[model samples]
Target: MSRLSDMLRTQRFDDYRFYHQSTINQTLHLISAIIFLGCYALLFTDAAIAGIVGWLAMLTRQTGHFFFEPNGYDAVNDVSNDYKEAVKVGYNQTRKIILLLVWGSAPVALYVYPTLFGLFDPPTDRFDFVRHVGTLWLAIGIGGGLARMLQLFATRDLTTGLVWAFKVLTDPFHNIALYWKSPLKLLRGELIDSSIADADWGADEVEEAPHLT
Candidate 1:
């Protein structure tokens, strides 16, 4: 339990310092986290609606990473962009692009095939079509996460895979906790998170292995 907690903390800390340097990005993540909570609530009663909400949150979150976060050499972390991408625990930019392409194509494929080559029942109306798409999106989201988790199990260790999965599942609540003040910082005209430079997790604690994606 202690090891798991430590790894989770390290992953979260590394994630914040490496990726979330933009106040705008942090603020967007806060919003995305809230939306994800809504999706979680709807998951039990209406999975299709939850899927729609989840993707909306994902887009909001990714927009911040893609458009706002800096992608240059990390002066604070003293690592190159390529280094970070290579060691990233979860989806790096390249993998994210592929995942997004698959996500984007799902609806189009469903639209053209209607039944998606007999995988789904033909929708009776537009709403039903959307629901079907949402369901498929939900599956894709789960599959994407699980696929990465399994990859980690093969490449890293069981503990690393489990920890990453746990981190992803609980990220919404954690983001809200971590970034609740990000909006105020953005309002103060702080474009970058200056405090990230002060992050001191100790060099000995840094993971030598590749992280999740």
Candidate 2:
């Protein structure tokens, strides 16, 4: 139990330090986290609403990654952008791009095909169409995470994959705890987080980032 806890902690730490150096990005994550918690609650009541809210949360989170997070060599962590992506336990930028591309095209495909390549029933109205899209997006969200988890089993190890899956599911709670103060810092004109401590700790966690197969 202790070992599992430690792995979760380390995964969260690595994710934050490596992926969320920008204060703006952290602030967006904070917002996403809050919405994700709400979506979690909604899952028990109205799963359709949960899926819609989940997409909103994901959009906010990815917006920060694509537009705000730093892409240069991480001087604090003494690693390059490529190194971090290669070692990333979960969706790296390349993988994320593919997911996002599919997400972005879903609406278009639905519009053109109406029945979405015969997967969904033809909608009677716009609201039905939107509901269908939301459900499809929901499947994509769940499937993407599961697929990556399985991929990690082959690429890293079974334990690493399971740990990462847990981290991804619990990230809303963790992000809320970690980044709640980020917006305040941004308001005070701090555009980048002072991640020196995180970087130092990360370096100790792994002497060299392992290249994935």
In terms of lDDT, the poorest run of 10 residues in model 2 is 195-204
Give the per-residue lDDT of model 1 (tens digit) for 1-213.
Answer: 877888988888888888999999999999999999999999999999899999999999999999999999989888888888998888889989999999999999999999999988899999999999999999999999999999889988888889999999999999999999999999999999998888776663454535334
Error of 2 at 172 (Å): 0.5
Listed per model in order, the count of residue pairs whose N, CA or C atoms clash below 3 Å is: 6, 0
Question: Per-residue alpha-carbon lDDT of model 2 for 1-213, expressed as tens digits?
Answer: 877777776777678778899999999999999999998898898776787899999999999999999999998788899999998888999999999898888788889998977888899998888887877788888999999999989988898899999898989998888889999999999999985344544334545547778
Best by TM-score: 1
Off by over 4 Å in 2: 198-208
Every model's TM-score: 0.95, 0.92
Segments in model 1 whose C-alpha atoms lie over 4 Å from true places: 201-213
Worst ten in a row by lDDT for model 1: 204-213
RMSD of each: 1.8, 2.0
